[model samples]
Target: MRALTGTGVLTRLALRRDRLRLPLWVVGLAALFASIGNSISGLYETDAARLENAQVRADNVVTRAFTGPAPGSSTGALTVSEGLVFTCVLVALMNILLVVRHTRQNEELGRTELVGSAAVGRHAQLTAALLVAGLANVLLIVLSTLALIGMGLPAGGSALAGLALGTVGLAFAGLTAVAAQLTESARAATGLGGLVLATTFLLRAAGDAFGNTASDDITVNPAWPSWISPLGWGQQLRPYGESRVWPLALLLLCSALSVLLAVRLSVHRDVGTGMLPARRGAVRASSAMLKPIGLVWRLQRGLVLGWMVGIAVFGAVFGGIGDQVDDLFSSEKSAQFVRDLGGEGDLVNAYFAGMMGLLAVVVSGFTVQALIRLRSDEENGPTEAVLATSVSRAHWLLAHTLIALLGTALVLAVLGLSTGLAYGAVSNDLTAALGDLLETTLAQLAPTAVLAGFALAAFGLLPRLAATVTWAAFAVCLVIGQFGTLLNLPDGLLDISPYSHLPNMPAESLTVMPIVVMVVLAGALTAVGVAGFRRRSLALGG
Candidate 1:
């Protein structure tokens, strides 16, 4: 009990700090779940439509890899099968980030140490972080259930689905708590948590994709691999199918173990430090390392490599699956349905084009992260150190800015190359497949540039709130680009996103006008950011 002292105050503090951010995550996820549920429900109202949907998914390795388990012959199961994995991912992300922010970020900022110096107990901060994370997951449960039920999904299934997702989320929260204790830097903590999330996701995906398909149309069985993952455990609950409670028990047990381990580790480690020691740097910096671009590269190299590997893996999977898409939709009716959904003339071309559109948003995340490093540097005192020398503010800022631009291009190009290579291998027309994928990939860079420019501009102008502003813009763009059509949002609203303006390549004629416009917008915003940084003093904190 003594170790948990002041947990309430710190918990409230976490809530206060995350007030706006927390709500946005909750509402955004709820909206996404509700929207997907509604769309699935409305699209397939009859038994025939539902079975057809299930059959297509059951046969498609790509769908199984991403979504997991074909739905049983019921509306609720269909909704669960379509939306469960993605929604669970979102919930896990929310919990992990929330825990890391309150724990490792506070320590990185020295707040944890300061609080610990007072009447606060050794475990208070971790306890508070866990408490806040638990509360958020509970809220997710309530909101998700209500949203699904409001969309006319069966109440029992909806509630079970919500509980399953929430359990997965809380489990990851506990994992993140342990990660926070293990890593000194918040970025490292978040990265560690992300790595776990990726591992579990892959485990679950591999199990689902390679798992047994029974003779009966209704049952898709996952093997032992899926049983090894927390996500897989949650999925095994099978909200609208089996509705098992035992898996939830396993998830909760894992969460409890993770939390207990974190608490024990906390007692052994010093405040503001990690259980695992950080590595020591070289005594002298190399000439190449001293250069601004090189320095920025060193800082961002880990992230770039991670993205490259992830994209390459994803590209291979997507490309491998692209070949099966045509065969899966062999029926003329299925072909027409895909074409209608894609709004493209050729089914294969349209599929590739739609994929490029989604990849654009993904690459934007990399772009934004790269650009935000400037804000991070400024806050951490590195910018001031660099600027105090012969380097001018504009030059130093532009050095990093240039890297962000070039890095975005590099990431996109790599994605294009890998995607084209794998896709061409299977598509059989190597040249045309490579050419089309590369062309679409390059065209999508316009929107990615726009996102980087926005982050850079926000960093320059709203130094303190740069992260908030940029992330909000990113979220809006993501929602508009991904869901605008389904939601039937206004053209004006959709037009606000740079992605909306890009020509749907391979499906439609390539339009140079929009690309040029997006590039100019990106350039102009970057200039604004440079000017803002030049005029303002560095906002470093003690």
Candidate 2:
């Protein structure tokens, strides 16, 4: 308690700094859950539709691996079964960033050192960050619960779902607190946390996939692997089934232990350092170091590689799940399920088209991150140093922008190839799958470029607001473009997303005009951003 002085003040500070960003994340996630609930409810309106759809998915190993068990046969249960893993992943991400931002980033920028001049305890900042993250999760739980209840889901189940999701967030926040103690660099800290998250996800996936199902076929009791993962504990709660409280104890207990470990470790390091020493750069520069693009790549290459690997895995999973429609159309009732998803007569084409849209949206996150790196560099000490020399702001911005655009296209290519390979293996048409998905993914480059341009424009014109604005835009676009139709949103609203302009490939004839227009639009927006950035003075530390 004596070592926790100024924790309350730091908590308020963290909250104030993140006021806008935190609410956006919470509300956006709640809305996303509501949309998913509404869409699943609408799609499986009847008992027969729900039951048959469940049966179709029950035996599919791919579906089981991805979605885990259906806790019950109801719409809300189906939503949890399909949505729990994905939603928890997002929640975990939100918390990891929160912890890393408040702890490691502050230290990296020397803010912690500045704060330490006061009577603040060594553990105060980490503790305050965790508290703020806990509060955010509380808001998420409340908002999401209300959203579900508003959608006419059961109050108990809704609360249970929200609680389970919140617990996973807290657990990850605790884990990230520990990661922040291990690494000197914020990026490396994030990567360490992500590696743990991925490991837990794989454990949960394996447990659920190999779980023992009841005679009902829909109900599953996951294997021993799930018991250790916080993610798996969320599912084990069975919000739609038993609504167990025991798993909450597991989550809380693990999180408490992790937090204690982090607190003890905090005493072992100085304010500006970590348990692990920071990496020292090489003494000599290479030829590639002279080029701006190469330098940008060197900084962002880890991010690019991570996205590529993630996209590849997801692409394979999504693509391999493609031809499994044979099992899905078990009866007349289940076939109507396909029609409800707005599929044409050819289910495969519709599935692939939908997945392409999702892939584009996912890959675009990396694009925004790459572009925002320029602003971050500016906010830190590097931009001024580089600009003091002969390097123009235009050249600096161009290198970042080009990498964002090109890296996005490259990742999209990996997505397409991986999907094509897995889908081709399953469908027995390797040439056709490769050719079609490659074209479909490439067609998305124009739309992704449009998003990159917007992010760059925001960075140039609104340096302080660049990160907030682009992430907000990304969230809005995701909700609107991804689930706008399911939510019965207007076409006018949906069309605001750049992804809306993507061609309906494989599902319909190629609409090259939209792609061409988007490309032109992206170029114009890129010019505006570059021009604005050139005229503006550096607003460092704003």
Candidate 3:
């Protein structure tokens, strides 16, 4: 009872802090789910059409890897099939960020100290964070279920689908709770949780991709690896297909265990510290760590390396799957759909082009991460210390911005090169694969630069709102670029995303004009941002 003291007040405080942000998340996800069903209904009017789509999914390892098992039943199930993997990833991210923000992030910022100075118990903060996260998952279930049913999906299936998503979020929420207790830094906590999530996603993808290979018939039989992933268990619920509920018990068990462990760990740890020991750095500073660029590199090198490794792994997996694209779709509908999106080119090239496009969006995230470090440094007083030295504020800001741009380019290149090498090894066209894949991947840099530039500008012009607005902008572009066509969003609106303007290289002609324009635009925005930052006072919060 003492451990639960002030839980109600703290939960209310967490909810208040996230009022606007939480609504956007719940609404955005519900909208995405609703859009999938709504759009698919029109695109797939007949059961035959849905069955054909499901057949392609069941047959194509690449499709199955990207999505999951095709329900092969009703259109609702088909919709769930197409969107489930992405939905699970998003839900997991939402919970991780939410839990870490309330728990570790609060401690990092010293807000937890102020709260704990009151009548609050030691475990109150952790309990409140879990409660807030739990409520968010519940809201996600309620809203998403209603959205699905409102789209005229089977109520039972919709409810199960929402429950599946919610339970996954809950599991991650619990995992993140443990992560917060295990790390002294919020970023480290987030990174650890993300690693777990990435592993689970890859496991799920691997299971689905290689799932049916053992059988002669191209039927859906996810491998044993799938059983180990929470996502896999959730997918096995088969929302509209088998409509199983037993697998959800695994999620419940895992979540319960995770939360229990986190609670136990919280009991052992001191406030403002973690169960994991912090690494000690050298007392002496190297010459390389003295300069602003060098210092920025030192601070950001780990983050960049982490992203590069993740991108490289993703690239290898994507490239290895290229062979599966050859005549993978026999149906005219599936082939034409690929053709329409990929241009009149080799199917494998089209697949690579789409993958590179996705990688482009992903690299933009890296860019944002690198650029946002400037804000963190500012808030934490490091920037002021650096500026007090020989370095000018503009130079300090510009150095990080440059790192963001160049680091992202390097990461993208690695992705392209890794994908090229892997795909070439499998396809036996090493030289051509290397050149084409590199070109396609580099072509995405223009849009990625635009996103980074925009984030920098937001940082300069609106310091307080920089993080929120920049991420929202990225989200908007991501939705527009990725799902605009599927959602039937207007062409004029879709054109707003810089990704929409980039040439779909390898599949189509690599035009120079649009890319050139985007680059120039990015430069202009960066210049404007730097100038604005020079004029603005520092935004430092304790």
Candidate 4:
């Protein structure tokens, strides 16, 4: 039989397996892009007004650093370009993780071995995985194009924009394929792919921030640094401006090259082994691994440290941008808008509070992930072995739960301290600002605890569906908190978010009732989860 025998059969089976997931990804991504296009079109109805607003907002260094350089002559095009660039990056990341998981990870788990024995050729599995990812990317392109054109964007420009978005996904899918071949563990492959994604974003951000001119002069053009990054190339296509199609070709060529490299690597590697062999660890367990809690800490320390660092950096950047808000508020109309957003509080403080709220949501996601780790361990059968030892069920549950609670608190505190210090330095009020920011950060603990409690409860009541339920709850909360104002959702609907009950910190005085209620809810849920876990048979798989 040929190396690629049964490739078509495997491809069909993989498609059947991922029927729902791939379509959801494609539809969600396209909808998000289209929504942004619709919002921009509505907001910037006049070309002259758009141009003026773009000149100001796009020129701001912090804005430029966050979003890529401005797109076309009109403001509407610039807004669409900025929003699409980041959305495309997110879509690409989703694709990379999904594709890598199914390809290399499935094989490593021995599922592919069963298939290979059943008349499947060596290359058939890889072919099927790549085909699934490719088809999903194509759907993304088509859906995005239709959504944009439906929203009244020029059809040709809309198609180019969607193609740009899909090109990023295709490129990253290829990169992930190569990464999957290089790493023995699925986690390591995902991490390496994430690192590549982050580096690309940072490089694109740097290029956009430093490479562009803010002035109105027609003679000067932005630097060519954006041309080097794949994301930059997408923006350079200038979806609405002279709309160049060659960048998509460039992305396609790069993707083809990456695929060739991945196939070549796969040809030499063993079924379960990586191109880079796994390193040997010390034969004995570390002193830190002796206790259940200690082992939990050790296992989770790297993830917590990464979260803390990310939160700190995010805080610092947001705080640093606080100094610019006053300058931005030079317009009385904008100043009034800021005031309305935050009542009578200091504008910068309000912005800081809002930033903290957003960070709280992110920290809550970490907390949920940490708590869900217990459910994963139990379902994987490792919990059975650990429970058979001296460790009681409560001890095991507590070890993970405490980590989630304490780790989230530490992350939030560090974020508040970092932001306060940065903002204080710029505003020349270090002591007071630090105190206020820290207070606000602590206030967020209540709502975050509520989120953690929900995750724990879900794990307890529905061990099989815990992860999905936990994330879905969090997603609902996030939507209510972030978009409630813009969408004009009713107060009752918005009130479902725990953060809604907590007084806006730094801007408003702290209250004890909401905090107490949150703590009680979290405690009750955790207790129930532990009780349920003790009674139920440990689940092995979905």
List TM-score per model, in order. Answer: 0.94, 0.94, 0.91, 0.91
Query: Against the true structure, candidate 1 has what lDDT?
Result: 0.82
lDDT of 4 at 427: 85
Candidate 3's residue-wise lDDT over 470-532, tens digit each? 888788777788667655799999898999997667888799999999999999988888888
Pairs of colliding residues, candidate 2: none
Q: Which residue pairs in candidate 1 have backbone atoms (N, alpha carbon, C) closer than 3 angstroms, thus clashing? A: none
Model 4, CA-based lDDT: 0.76
Candidates 1 and 3: which is better by lDDT? 3
Instruction: At residue 98, give the lDDT of candidate 2.
Output: 94
Q: How many clashing pairs does model 2 include?
A: 0
Which one wins on lDDT?
2
For candidate 4, the 10 contiguous residues with the lowest summed lDDT are 214-223
lDDT order, best first, reads 2, 3, 1, 4
- To one decimal, what is the Cα RMSD in angstroms of model 3 from the true structure? 2.8
lDDT, residue 392, candidate 3: 91
Which ranges in model 3 have alpha carbons more than 4 Å from their true place? 38-49, 52-56, 59-66, 209-219, 321-336, 344-350, 482-492, 540-542
| Cα TM-score of candidate 4 | 0.91
lDDT agreement with native, every candidate: 0.82, 0.84, 0.84, 0.76
Give the runs in model 1 whose Cα sits over 4 Å from its true position.
324-342, 540-542
State each candidate's clash count.
Answer: 0, 0, 0, 0
